[model samples]
Target: MIQNQHLFHIPVMGTGHSIDTPIRIAHLGINSVVSVVDDMLCEKIRQHYSSVHNIAYQNIPKSAADGRAERITAYLNLMADIVGQKFDELKKMSLLEGTEKDRYFRLLPESNPLRKSYDKIASLTNQAVRQNLIKEITGKMTLGSIDVNIMAKVDALKMGDDGQPLSSEYSDASSALRGYANSKLSSSLVLSAGFNPRLYSYLSEFKDFYRDKTGDIKKKIILKVSDFRSALIQGKFLAKKGLEVAEFRIESGLNCGGHAFASDGYLLPVLLNEFREKRNQLKETFQPMIQSFYESQGWEYPELSEEETTPKITVQGGIGNNGEMRRLLEEYGMDATGWGSPFLLVPEATCVDELTSKVLANAAEKDLYLSNVSPLGVPFNNVRGTGSEKYTRELVEKGKPGSKCPKGFLVSNTEFTEEPICTASAEYQLLKINSIQESDISDEEKENQKNRVMDKTCLCTNLGTGSMIRLGIMKPSYGRQAICPGPNIAWFNREYSLDEMVDHIYGRRESLVPKERPHMFAKELTMYVDYINELAILADPEDAEWKKLLRMKKNLDAGMELCMEIAKGSSYEGENLHSLQSTVEEQKLRLAEIFNLVPSEA
Candidate 1:
């Protein structure tokens, strides 16, 4: 396992929010992931940083040969260079009070060795001894990794000017992978969403993914999975190709930001319990497969200890406070936890313009919801008063309800056009609306169908506009910024400095969330119940959808039972363990009513 100095890492936010996070915070020894979904956004940010640092700049035009991959490579290399320089400068500074070096040690967990050492050496009377110890500690300081993320399924096939589809290697995800593989970064590549066999196969081409003589993988693999079964399946597939999964980062489906990949009624606690109990099975099942592949290729399989070969299991999503974080790390045996949505409120961490930041800060629980805004048709965690929401709604009110489709990253629809166009595009919506109007269905049904068709917002461009607007790359008038923050953002009602946010994470100061906030486990459970209830209402009685809903109900019942046991176990102050018990009862009664009203499949 790669040794992370921090107990928690920031997962990738929208394509641009965390794009430059490494440059902002990696010198402080905090690991963060950058999204490589939009190469155009990357190129712009790279140009901005290059000019700021007075580095030589060159543009990779869209029509250039292998431009997507080249652009991503250039941006990542620039990021690596910038982060290294910043870290070197940070290490050279004296440990003066309130200095950057002081902030670095102060942000660390109280139990961390460096923090403890700094604490002990602060009161030393002998200047010579103190300076010696400080030098030794500074020499041991490591730079936080600048990891990159690729949504595995966001691989839209590109088209040449001649209108012919590009080769499979030129797809969105493939080019992004190649870009990362070619970069100088020695960090992990987090593959979120789901498995794409073609993308996984492409990993075999990159030698960095394999082990070297020192038994170290230069480029590691971290699969952001929702459950244990997914980990086993994808892990084994990669293992057969001699690619080891370094970590399985579990995230909540409905409770997370960005595109929600809702699981089949599998709650976070139940999922973590499975991984904790079956963690050994992962290594046991993959080691032989990897060894066999290595032997077949005449490669030396390094004789490493079991600890090095075993994959790290981590969890993220809706983790609000230290108590919940402790339960995830200690009780569930998670190696680390992820803190995403709350960082949207931390200006020192993520990129949020003044207008959008205020919206996220003042957003009530009712304002943050699971929305149908993604053109990909995935449920997205969205805030109420985003500029994108207002713009899209205004367009509808004016009888013109669709974007012009400038960027086609999420284009998957080929219904009306010979080539695929984004459903959020004006062309597609108009085509779809006309068909609905001419159909024989009732006016009410037509309106409902039209509403669903127009629900898709242009996420490919809008999601990244916040960063552009904040960085002065574009005017706020032209930037209809869309931000996806989880429901947990409701409790954090103000902007925070980087130190304040890190303090909240380490429990070094007062809690940032309110007392009325629900526990993470209970919050996820309630979401699953509400989700199934919605499906139950829409599902036809005799269809296969109803059967699926029945199975989800059974799974929720079992999950509630586990929640009850957890509530009875150990209670942390302000964690609201009692609320977990009450939520189980309340949601269970609601679930019973929904199912009772809908008949079971006969």
Candidate 2:
């Protein structure tokens, strides 16, 4: 496998957290991904990057959308303008002369007192001039070669305005793939939100871009999976459609920020090892199936190169230090590791309100917890004490259950209306609260229901407006900011520059030196234990809860066994290892206590 020079990737944060993310990363000549959920912000960043830096910046923007031709078309049109505007600026810069040209070429010495200030200004001027010169000399402006990969979440694909599945012509995934097909600025389509056969079939229509002249795939498709089974299943499904995934991005369930999709109990280290061992077998099994599919469709089965068929394995979640980062890459053969929450501290790469960033920097372990704040019903990583959370509670105390719901992105509930409504909407929450009060249940249940209703925040606007509030650009009435940072943020106590973060990733420097931090495996186990306790509380005295508990116990047992194996084989012999062993033993005791509560199978 070809190891990337930029071995790290910045995964998609919320619409607000990663606003202008790519532009900042590109300024340092690094590869980065941007969230395109907020298309207007994406367009603005694209325009600014192209105009300021004459070189075509390669960025990946993730789209979580319903299949709308108009929506996809708007993004493409904006992209076209972004590219056109960049070249126009480059053309103007090509004609620079005198002091302007001199300043562009001149490199200020580090010893100069004003070097830092001058270098910042001159870097932009120098880069633009240099790019213009390269274009002039080569007589080739490869505008189309600009990288702009689009990420589409399969499960989140929106239906048409008529409340039907989008037609093939207007299908979101297909349109995005076809829109950029064969164009110089063509972007790869990354399929996320797990596997969907219909989405794969729709993409097969553009076989030309999906597969190259040599039968090798030209366009890249990345699948975000939580476990080996999901990866294998998705890989086989794609191969059956005569397609091969370029990468399998494995994310941790509870350790990540935003939507926390906790696994039944599958831990990260075990999942990685499984993938490492089965990767070759997986590729070998899928290749012929893909070839057979092509043959069945009366198409010539393209012989794929070794690299073309083999998908790179990548992991993200709770990766706090260079030691863990290096181990994942070197030990598991992972191609890339993602850093998301840490970048929130680096204002250069991610958007965070100054107040929110401070809150995150000063946050302790208890401050960051998984909560039912998302309107989507998914458990979201949330900060306990933020302006947004405080505002949400204040409104609840005042008998107002929900926010204004200005941008109705998460409005997909039909609980009270003929048309869909957001659960966090004032209309819906007010209705829900009244119903819960009248329900034939215990007072405890009523209180629990009320708390859940009040917990729902307007994540759509709250997530996007934090940076605007931090920059003193826009201030919403409900709150100034909301931040979603993973548990790992607690270990990193200070803000860092992008360079400092990169240095930490590459082991050049240690930016995060916490007094006490649990091993990643131990941390994951602890999360699972906490989750089990919560489940136990809500669990009924029935077969269903028993079955769930049994499954969880099985997974926990497997995870603990793996932890022991790691401890036995690991070279490190120190306090860290002792802490890991202690944590594992503690989890074992907790698991046993839960297991004892379960009724006997006999």
Query: What TM-score, over all chains together, does every model reach?
Result: 0.97, 0.79
- Evaluate model 1: give its lDDT: 0.90
lDDT of 2 by residue, 138-197 (tens): 232222222333434422334565677655644444555555443333334555554657
Which regions in candidate 2 have their CA more than 4 angstroms from the true location? 1-3, 27-29, 40-188, 207-209, 214-218, 295-304, 470-480, 571-575, 597-602
> Where does model 1 exceed 4 Å of error?
597-602
Q: Residue-wise lDDT of candidate 1 within 573-596, one digit each (tens)?
A: 558788899999888888878777
lDDT of 2 at 80: 48
Weakest lDDT window of 10 consecutive positions for candidate 2:
100-109
> How many clashing pairs per prediction, in order?
0, 3
Best by lDDT: 1
Q: How close is each model in CA RMSD to the real structure?
A: 1.9, 7.7
Angstrom error at residue 232, model 2 = 1.6
Candidate 2 is scored at a TM of 0.79
